[model samples]
Structures are given as C-alpha cells and as structure tokens.
Target: MTQTGSYLYAIAAPVGDDVLGGLRGVADEPVRAVRHRDLVAVVGTVDIGPDGPFGEEALAQNLSDAGWLAAVARAHHAVIDGVARAVPAAPLRLATIVADDDGVRDRLERWQDGLRRTLDEIAGHAEWSVKVHAPQPADPDTDPQPAAGAPGAGAAYLLRRKAVATARDDALARASAVAGQVHEELARHATDARRLAVQDQRLTGADTPMSLNGAYLVPVAGADAFVATVEELRERYPDCRFELAGPWPAYSFVTVEEP
Candidate 1:
C-alpha cells in the first residue's frame, strides 16, 4: 500500500477558501489548506511509501536527480507564489512533510504566535535574487584565436601562459571586490540582505563563474527602485555582468523560528 503524507509549503492567515482551486502540488495532487484558529497551512498529499517518487525509501536517489528536484521545486514555488500574491505568508522549508492534515493543524497551533510574527516581518517585502558573473577566457577550440600578439611555441608560449594566468587571477580578484560593492549598494535600498553561496556556471547557466549570489528583501512598494538599482549596477560593472530575478515569495526573509 502507498502511504501518503501531507507536504506543507507555506503558512498564512485565513487564506481564501478558493485560493488553491486549480493549484497542484507534489505529484500533481490538488492543493488544499489546513486551518487552525485564524491560520492556514497550504498543503498537498505526497506519497511516502516505497516506489513513490517522494518516498523516504527513494529520497536520496530522487534528490540526486537534478530533473526531479527541479520539477518539484518549480511546482512548490508556483503554489507559494500564488498564495503570497493573494496574501502574506511564511514559506516553509523545502520538502517539509507531516503525516496528515491533523499533524499539519497541530504543528500550526503549536507555532501559531511565532509563525504570525514571521509573516509580519515579511508582510511588505519580497525577495529578489541577484547574481554577478565574470567572463571566462575565450575557448581555444571554437575560436582558434588567442589574444592578439599570440605566442606559437617554446619559451614565448610558456611566458604567455604565465601572463594569462596572472591576468585571470587579477580579473577574479577585481570581480570579487566589485561584487562586494554591488551587494553593499543594493543592501542600502533593501530591508534586509543575504549573500548566498556563489553558484557554478552549470547551475546558473551563466557564461562566466559567479562572484556573487545575493538575495535582498525589498519592500513591495520599493520594488521598482530595486529594479532600477539593479540596472544601474549592470552599467557600473561592465566587466562583470549582473542578472536579477524575482519579487519571489519572501522565501529568504522569513523563518518560523525567528523572534
């Protein structure tokens, strides 16, 4: 028998009954809200039995598969964004599961006051992601053209390689310094800021390695200003490109355990 569990995504206050009408969650199951007092928990059923996609038996394997993780994350974010847009909420950690709706209600009741305060902290803010990348050296196979005044072989080639290495190091150092400045500038206009670990090009789909991966909690009212500042950053750092995404569901700003 396939045993199912309730997966919790976010918590809000008295969410509209019809808010999740057409929404789906893990495994494409219909989403519903579990309520206790004046609070509601957005939830959906996820199988936790052997052979189930999200089952504990296969949890490690599933996490190792990038495609599966991405699909699930997308679904989770879609529902979270929907609820956040309609009303303020505190997004739960990824893949938080409970045995059933009763478990969901119990947990919500236990954490009611703390969770409410978490919601209040992020009431007027959304998270925005910013990344900066420094371009990599041109590929030799595809371009076949090295920097002007190229060295063919022998002593000149060795010296050229040494110089190239030094230049690359310098560029990376400069990129790091600039990334710090960018974060400081953005943080000035944000309620709070968090510097996430830099991401690999493979994960970010960027042309160069990332120097900064930051998330800023910008007020909903000041979202336009945040975006404008990002544009200014783009111009300010020509050697390193900047990318901005979201008005995301206050994911980075809320913690259920927070005071």
Candidate 2:
C-alpha cells in the first residue's frame, strides 16, 4: 500500500494571491494554503513510498545514519529557501510531517496570531552567524628536576607543577577578557543577538579558545553594513581569529507564536 505525507512549506499570515504566487515548495511546486481561521499553513504534497524521503522505514533508518541525516538537511533547506523569498516564514524543524492536509490545518488554528506576528516581524530580514575562536597557546616545555633521594621527589615535583598551572590560568583569564570585549562591540550593531554553545576549536579554526559563537538577525538593507562592521571588528582584533558565515534562513530566530 502507498502512504502519503504533508510537506509543510511554512507557517505564515493569510496572504493575497500576489504573495502566494511568489512562493514555492519542494521541487518548485506552487504553494497552497490550508487555512485555520486567522492563520494559514502553506504546503505541498509529498509521497511516502518505501524509498520516499519521509517513508516510515526511511525515517527510522535516519535515526542513526549520517548520510541520511545530510539528505534530510538538504531537503529542508530547499523548501525553506523557496518560501522565504516571498513571505516572512518560520521554517519548521526538519521532517515535521503530518498525516494529511487536515493535520496541517489543525496546527494553524492552534497557533494563529503567534504565527502571524512572527511572520510580520521577520519579513525582509535574514539571519547571520559569527563565531570567534581563541587559538591555543604553544605549550611551554618545562624540564622536570631530578629528585635528590627519590622518595621525597614526588612532593617537590607537585609544588613545581602547581606554580606552572597558576601562570597558565592567569593567561587564560586575560584572553577571556579580550573575547568579552569583542562580543559586546558586535552586539551593538545587531537587531538581536544570541550566544550559541561553543563549537569545538578544531571545527572553528580559532587559535585561541572559542570566545563566542553567536547568531544575529539583521535587516536586509543593513546586511552590507553588518558585514562591514564585522570586517572592522576582524581588523581590530588581529590577535584573535574571527570566523563569519551566513545570510542563511532564520533558523534560530523563528519561534511558534504564543497565545
């Protein structure tokens, strides 16, 4: 037997024909509305065959599979990319499928005004991510002193180790102070800012410890200015590594409307 799924495009306010014309879903499918009184859910049809993107077995397999995870991520981006061009949208979590159109309508009814306001607020803005990494300092190789009698040498060695640890701690504290300054300066230019969990140094390519991993929502007109501000920041903080990426879909900023 063949199964089916509702592929959500986005949750948006009730829009006119002109706005709907500009929106598309997976595979360039024209967006259609499933209305629930005050709110509307834009969606397209998706197949749920054995080999389809959201098939029951396929979903289960992705629970532990890296390749499956990547494919799903791409599919999600494609859908969001299309709709965001036309409307202020809150892209749902990946694979947020429902049984059919009725289920989509039910969600719209439950979250109407919150969805409307979220869409209005985000219209014409995009999300950008920036992170700062503090590079690891080169290890200072200290020679171990030989013990005179051997039995009491362990106690002396520990004392020397403690002194070295104290010095390193002082250095880390200074670096952290510098990082804080950078975050504060950058926050001044953003409409909204959020500090994300520190990513691994290896992934971030920062020389110092990661000082900041943050997301910002900036107006489209201010995008160039935002990039320029970040460039100036990079020039100002030559001692620290600054990594910047995005103009991506507003993943972190979007939230369900509250009653």
Candidate 3:
C-alpha cells in the first residue's frame, strides 16, 4: 500500500462548510480543514513512505525540490486567498507540511493565541512593495574633451575624473537620504513596514541605480492615500526611479510562534 503525507496549506479561523467548499490544492485535490479548538489547518493529501518523511534523503532535500516547492507554494497561496475572503488569516511558510492531521492539531493548540493576534492585526489589510532606482553616472568617454597634447592635458584628465567620482558619490548619498525619507513617510501611513533585499541592477534590466526596496502593510482604507503619497514623493525626487506594486497577501509580516 502507498503511504500518504499531509500537505499543509494554511492556518485560518474555523471556516464554515460553504466557505470551505470548491477550493483545491496540489493535483487538484479538494481542500479540507483539520480543526483543533478554535483554529483550523487547511490541508490536502500527499504520499509519504516508511523510510521516514518521504522518498528523500532528508527533510531539506524534499523541501528544496523545485516541483514540490512550486506545488506547495500554489497550494499555500490558494488556501490563503480563500480564507482571507472569509476571515483574517496567517499564511504559513511554503512547504510547512507535517506527517498527518494530528501534527496540525497539536500546532493549532500550541499557538492559538499568537495566531489569533496575528489574524486580528492583519485583518482587512494588505502588503505592498516599493523599489526605487537612480540613473547611472554618465560614462567618461562620452564627455566632451580637449584635443590630445592640449595645455595641462594630463592634469585636466585627472581633475575631471576626480570631479566625476565626487559627483557620483554625492548622487549616491543623496539617493540614500531620499530613500530613508520615503521609508519614514510611508511608515506613518502603514500598519507595518520592512526593508527587503535590494535588487541588483542587472536583474532590474536598467542602467538606473537602486536606492531602496521595501514592503509595507497598509489598511484597505488607506491604500489610495498611500499611493498618492508615493506619487508626491516621486514628483519631489525626479532624479530617482520609484516603482510600486501590490496589495498582495501579507507574506512579509506574518510571524511564526514557537511551539
């Protein structure tokens, strides 16, 4: 007989039968809830083996597999979206599956209060990402130059290089300052904020410089105003690039409680 594994989707408030209906997980498996006290663990079925944890060397290997990772991510997002429509929810990290429904029940019993607080805090709010980039310094060869052997040619070249370096440094410093200002201003309008990894220029496909990459949790009511504030800041700092996206699930803000 083939052994089975429990695929954990998300933890949410106890949802009604109607609310839980019509949702699917990996392989189009119908989603089900494992209830423990006031908490519910949305789950689906997977295959586990007697070798312990599945047909893999270790838990890490199983978790890192690309196809497995993608399935879990999709399942997690799907359940999170469904639960969020009905009630506030705290989405677990991708591939947070355990051996069976019992493990989920244990977790729910263990972390009930913290989960409640997290859900309450995030209710009716969503996350947003903002990234800023600045233009790269102009190349030296592109600059107008005097003919070779002109008076003070060597000295002028050194002086010009020094000036260019100074200007680049100054621009970088200004961009940093502006990024701080933007973060601070946005924080005032958001329930929570975080600084994320700065994206590399090559990845961004722009000669523009990246000054900031940040996430913010904003109430639904405040989203329009928050966007307007960002637009105003963009106008104020015409030299830098300001990009914004989302209204996504609060992935960055959820905290896992110790069991």
Candidate 4:
C-alpha cells in the first residue's frame, strides 16, 4: 500500500470549503482546506511511501530529472496560483508534505503570527517581474600598427590596449548607471522592490546582455499605473530594452517560515 502525506500548497486567511470545491492539486488529487485558528492550509493527499515517487530518497533523485521536476513544479504552482487568485495566499516551497492533517495544523499553529502578517501585507497587492537588457557593447576599431621589432612598436601596442580597455569599462559603467536609474524610477511606483541577480546570456537566450532582473510588489489598484510607468521608462530610455510580466502572487515579498 502507498503511504500518503498531505502536500501543502499555500496558507491563507479562512478560506471557505466552497472556495476549494472541485479544485485539484498535485498528482491530480482533490484540494482540501485544513484550518487552524483564523488560517487555512490548501493541501492535497500525495503518496510518500518509502519507495513511492515522492519518497525522500526518490524525491532528491527526481529533482535532478528536468522533465519530472518541470511537471511537478507546474502542478504545485498551479495550485498556489489558483488559490492566490481568490485570497491573500502565502505559498509554501514546492513539494512541502507532512504526515497528515495534524501535521498541517501544527505547521499553521506554529506560524500563525507570521502567516497573518504575510497575508495582510499581500492582501491587496501582486508581484511583477521586470528585466532590463542592454545592447551588446560595440567592438572597438583598431588603428594601423607599426611593424613588429620597429622602434617604439611595443610602447604603441601597450597604449592601444589600455585605450581599448578603458573604453570598454566606460561603456559598461554607463549601462550600469542606466539600469540603476530605471530601477529607482520603478520603485517609486511599487510598495516593495527586490533586485535579483542578472541572468547569463545563455539562460536569457538573447544577444543583448541583461543588466537588471527585478521584482516588485504593487498595489492591485496601482497595477495599471505601474505598467504605464514601465512603458514610460521604455520610451525614455531607448538604449535599454525593458520587459515586464506580472500581477502574479507576491512570491518575492512573502515571508513564510519553512516547516
């Protein structure tokens, strides 16, 4: 027989049973609500036997399999994303499972204070992702060089190299400054903002280099203005390309304590 565990997707303020009706979670299992005090946990039953796919040992191995990870991640996020649409939800890390409802209650009871605060913070807000990519730095033109072993040949070569390096450095510095300006301007329109690490060219699959990867928490009412600000910045700074995606759950701002 497959031993089962409760796979927790998110925590929210008092979700009614009717709200979760017909909703499915990980493994295509029926979603249910487990309440503790004023908070409710969104969960689904999942197999976690010693040899089951989600068994601790097997889970570690499965995470390394791209296809398996992607499938599970999609399912997990789907549940959280759905719940978040109806309530101020604080999502748990993917694959958070416990022994049973009692365990889920224990987690809720233990984190009630923090959970309530997080819920309050996210009640009327959503997360937005913004990326700023700059055009690739232009290659420098080379000046005709003196023949090797000629007088002052080495000196001229050293001077040319130094000039090229300085020019490249200056270009990068300018790009960085522009990125900072854009982030600052956008922050003015957001309730909270986070600057994430820039992605590599290979990961972005773009010829241009990424200068800024940012997350912002904005009020639902201000969402339109926030998007407009992004568009405005795009026009104001033609040298940098801006990409915006959002109205998602406050993934970057939610401070849920791990079980």
- Give lDDT tens digits, candidate 3, residues 182-241: 999998999999988888888898676688898999999999999999999999988888
Best by TM-score: 4
- lDDT tens per residue, model 1, 1-259: 9899999989986778688886888689988888898889999999988888878868779878999889988989988988898888888877888899999988888888998888888887899999988756433333244555766545555666776787778778888998999999999999999998898779777776899999999999999999999999898877788889998988888766633
TM-score, candidate number 1? 0.87
Tell me the alpha-carbon RMSD of every candidate.
4.1, 4.4, 3.2, 2.8
- The Cα local distance difference test for each model comes to 0.85, 0.72, 0.79, 0.86
- Count residue pairs with overlapping backbones in model 3: 1
- Clash pairs, candidate 1, are none
Off by over 4 Å in 1: 135-154
Off by over 4 Å in 3: 17-19, 50-75, 138-143, 148-156
What are the clashing pairs of model 3? 134-209
Q: Which scores greater on TM-score, model 2 or model 3?
A: 3
Candidate 4 achieves a global lDDT of 0.86
Better of 3 and 4 by lDDT: 4
- List runs of model 2 lying over 4 Å from the truth: 13-40, 47-53, 138-175, 202-208, 257-259
Backbone atom clashes (below 3 Å) for every candidate: 0, 7, 1, 0
What is residue 218's positional error in candidate 4, in angstroms?
0.6
RMSD of 3: 3.2
Residue-by-residue lDDT tens digits, candidate 4, 112-139: 8888999999998999999988745555
Ranking by TM-score: 4, 1, 3, 2
Worst 10 residues of 1 by lDDT: 137-146
